[model samples]
Target: MIKILICFSVIFSSGIGLNLYATHHQPVNESNALDLAANSKSAILIERDTGEVLFNKNAQEVLPPASMTKIMTLLLVMEELENGKLQLSEKVRISEKAASMGGSQIFLEPGEEMTVNDLLKGVAVASGNDASVALAERIAGSEEAFVEMMNQRAKQLHLKNTLFQNPTGLPAENHYSTAEDMALLAKELLKYDEITKYTSIYEDYLRKGQENEFWLVNTNKLVKFYEGVDGLKTGFTNEAKYCLTATAEKDGMRVIAVVMGADSTKNRNSDVSAMLDYAYSKYTTKSLFDKNQQVTSFNWLKADQQKVNVITNDSISILHKKAEDLTGIETDVKIDQDISLPIKKGTAIGKLEVKKDGKVISETDLVIEEDMDKAGTFQLMGRILRSFLNK
Candidate 1:
């Protein structure tokens, strides 16, 4: 076993692919081995579907996220929108405190009303401090309360290194996140398609046709310049420096890349672009099976139903490098010898493990696809008699 510790500043500028583990404890096939390094303080590139880290550099180093903190803010808004607690068409009355927020705003005035849709646009496109505070206050009744919610949600998401001091990514002591944490947040935000509707817009008008209509443009320029790039956030502050958490999809593969604490905008964009380019150029995503795809069937012990179908609870996909032959990869499905009665539809019977060159690459739970009820004593005896007679 070889441990390769990569320093990005030296090797990344040359565009060399580092044969780093796309994930820890799993080895890519020799043919698929590639090295990736990025010139940034902290960076990570992950496949969205599988959450595989194609490349990482100081990914766990906690740092101020600046406006990228709004990813969590957006996540909370998305949660409210998804649970039907908030509506896009519903109007939110701006508070004096919200309007008083500093840096990157749509210039919302106190007592002015804006729909949730427009407010989301302001946060996603303009990186609006005022808009973020308004939505935060609307959801949690106060920015401080909303920040509490953010921390709670972070805990739920198992993000240990993330903390939120404010909703709008303002520089504050003790408010910081790791690239890994921010990338995870970006992944959660992508679950809501409505977010992309605003993040993808290169330019649009807020309060259209009004006397004080504000022209909103996306702070993340990669939306226009990079192919397959759509929605994400960018950040910069004296403390946070230039940072971006970007996501893009191409040919069924979605990637999330985070670059934080860059020296300049050019450096930040370049580093993110390089990480994304490396991911797209080197990998291909392949789904092994769809959810409910039958793996095998087995007779149930002590069940009225004679057989239970085993299947995958969710689809499984793998990111293999272009040069590698997926056929070379091995899959072994390990299942229980006898499935017992009273089985639930999603009960895990065992697991399917994927290996490349003897190293475990991925694993998915194998589950019973349908419920199995226990059989009465008489019924079990009758079935046994029938089976014996047939044999």
Candidate 2:
């Protein structure tokens, strides 16, 4: 009888005890590799959703960005639209300076009028230099002032290797950017889906009834040739060579590719396509948690609820190899021990860390699932008294 009792006790304790045993472990295969530009000066391919760089070559080396600078100009315009300072239907009159501008142009005659929508299409689809200048002037009163705003916005975006001499990306003495910086700018631009509506159009007519009416064809040929390819811009000059910022989406994954100073447009298009194909083929996104999913429980102080549910702010997904087994993924949730009297719903209180083989690979914010109002003084005193009496 004594031996049997001892054996039962050991079994019960072992079953109840928490053990730090490894749940899953697997090796990642790296057989898949990305194809790159042959005669390209610099190139980079990034996962759009997660901002992960899958391939990079000379990405940090600063060089002339040519019309790729227009990406930033469009970004600032979008910012204004988002802030309610400008509207798409609002008409802007072309200034004398804008009308007189040389190079790729919308042929805006002085005092000619066009909607913001048309100007955006002119710049995005046709890479119209005059339209860029006209928009810049209308937005900031002068091209020089708009250029200052562009530089300031670049600094705020932390584009370390980017400098802008003009909004139209006309070859200036000092206009320059790096593959990495252009990638960063492209990533930001992708956030504005409205921009793609213009960039992706293969052909369109601008200024239908005006004397400046002109037919426009998208300069970025990838939008027409490559599947799932949308935005963004293409640039070329004797000095800047051929530059393109292209984005493509496949199987719920979006990828951004930047190529600067390609020897030819054909090479630029091919490089971008190869890099995008490599990204979609090798990696897939895995969602770990859904929005509002309960990640953990935390104690609340002086509140009606004893415990609060910790929820995820947004659904989180990470890029992983297609063949790699997911049995190795481990999730750990960490929360504050005692949240103070007042806690608001959606307030970030902790973090959920996802790991593979004890190495943290991804993380998401943990938020309060529900609101907890502060207790009144009387309620607080009553709770204190109750606690003392129980003790």
Candidate 3:
């Protein structure tokens, strides 16, 4: 979820390239054992917090993402939940269109009703095309509208090569994304954290105690077979071949890896596994701030509130090669100086940059803790006048 935005109306930089002393760092090797170049059409591995690229092969090549398209679907669903526009307990009626979806489904009957929670389970654990359409219809009033939302979001994230023809990664004429873009989507989706509760489940019964109960299993098998590997998504198509976006957390550092257009499932898994191995072996992270931790504050006579707290939008970290020396590290915080009021929550108020040897190694946005509206004209004058008199 790198180096990507999870909030509405947010923009992200492509992230730092760690040229810190310009040592000619390269994460890819065709002759090396990583095998990402040989096993997959496109692939990328990145640190979740720092958005640092560890290794990449054909990362920007646009290819069908298959079922991994649901990563954006899940991201939008989580945003609705976080914004209180949707609730997990809410119920949705299955539409005929939703029920008629082909390829990898939970088999929802027409007119059947399911909770948003269960539909998420179906989509996350089963790659349910029907469930994806169900949630899409509920959120945006139609699958077409939801697909529009998905494309708009992709643009907002500054993803250049991604476009959505549908919510499920079912084969479609114009539906495609790059490995780097898919990794960013997974990074954005992972900010919800609660998503793993569904994505990590290897097996579960969807309609328990019912005669037509459906058994749902995760398409991403690494969650069950690999230690610390929790989620993401897997896909296969006659055209797209096999794909997987996988994440694992070990020793407090989480990493995401994406593989697209592999010839077979075993190769797909092998490629991602090798990518993960490369990340864990070569790099480690230094934590700076936990998510939502206060970094600074500001007060102004023109604001409705007397003061506003600035905090990190997400946890901040610095990535380093495991054997690299730790020295010459410094952090710089710069808050916006130009005065403006009525800023909404999640608005970037400032920047935090970490430099090593006077070069920026990492950067993250610092945001306001809550909304701030303008102060009354008279109130602002009074504060300014009082300050002048006191001085």
Candidate 4:
């Protein structure tokens, strides 16, 4: 590792800005927003692209997540798939502990084998506790270890209001999360849009042409009843009552709404629907850059190809009240820390901040477009000779 100091390398250009928003580290304040939740104890709505708050009511209050804990479980599973640690086509064997998961399960038997794709369906659509534990075991070798990974991931995301004691979100002491945390978790999960293909399913079958063919139905009713509502998860237990974290995209703007501690499924779905209605009717977003859009390029003396493109990990957008005008836009690019050769494909190189009137309104991490390897001795020598000749 060479000593290198790179910070605020340039001020790039993007578009759209008016009001400002702090990053997730600071709570979003959508003042003057409507009270969309009539029955839920705590609820929140945020634009997915910018993570700007659209509505809020006791969003930080911690409570039982119930099956919504599967959001974190799904996130880790998605991450493992992305990292090539797990494959959708690969099969995971069910352990006795996994098959023992009782509440809201797909009825996996001990020693049964299921593909990762089907297990994902089981968790996302059926809220199968058995599937969750099976995947947890496959990823971390055990459910207990997977729970630790959940806590570590929560801390990495800067979720101050979440603490996980189990992967199934089963009733346990010290197992709690907030509307804000679950919404953020859903946002993270949405980064892999492929998940919606499963969560959006209203009904499906687990076993094909078998005597014990089991039917699977999505616990989230809004996926079918509500237009543009694709997913998320629903939760229910004696202690937690009813809960939901829903995501919907309409006319280019995607939003996440979370309703927890509702009295009934009707109230839970209504709270989420009301929040989504408020968001789409009141808010819009301006796309600044597509995913993987190049922000800038710089040379690294140590790499085989010195010139590397810096791009965003996700699409960049600016959230706006539908009635407001867009103006006062400024973009700043900052190299977060030391930069050297041998960078990974998705490693954060810095951050891009969209500002309005000197305050940051939107922020996203900048990443290396692809992996880079250090130059060999011959390549370095040839570069030195070329520099000497040019001079």
Highest TM-score against the true fold, candidate: 4
lDDT of 1: 0.80
| Candidate 1 local lDDT, 213-305, one digit each (tens) | 999999999999999899799999999889999889898788998998888888888888887888788887876666668866766547677
For every candidate structure, what is the RMSD over all alpha carbons to the true structure, in angstroms?
A: 9.3, 10.0, 5.8, 2.2
Error of 3 at 21 (Å): 10
**Residue range 225-317, candidate 3, lDDT tens digits:** 888899999999999999999999988889999988899998999998888887788777777789999876656556778777889988887
Model 1: colliding residue pairs: 17-35, 18-34, 18-35, 18-36, 19-35
Instruction: Tell me which of candidates 2 and 4 scores higher on TM-score.
Output: 4
Worst 10 residues of 2 by lDDT: 1-10
What TM-score would every model get versus the actual structure? 0.74, 0.73, 0.90, 0.94
Per-residue lDDT of model 4, residues 1-391, tens digit only = 5343344523335334444464643434554356578799998888888887777888899999999999999999999999999999999999999999989999999999999999999999999999999999999998999999999999998889999988887899999999989988998999998999999999999987898788999999999999999999999988999999999999998899999999999989988988888778877888887888998887777788878888988988887777776665667877755777777899998888877766776688989888988999999898999889999
Displacement of the residue 220 alpha carbon in candidate 2, Å: 0.7
Model 4 lowest lDDT segment of ten: 3-12
The models' CA-based lDDT, in order, is 0.80, 0.76, 0.83, 0.86
Kindly indicate the candidate among 3 and 4 with the higher TM-score: 4
**Candidate 4: which stretches are off by over 4 Å?**
1-17, 22-33
Better of 1 and 3 by lDDT: 3
By lDDT, the candidates rank as 4, 3, 1, 2
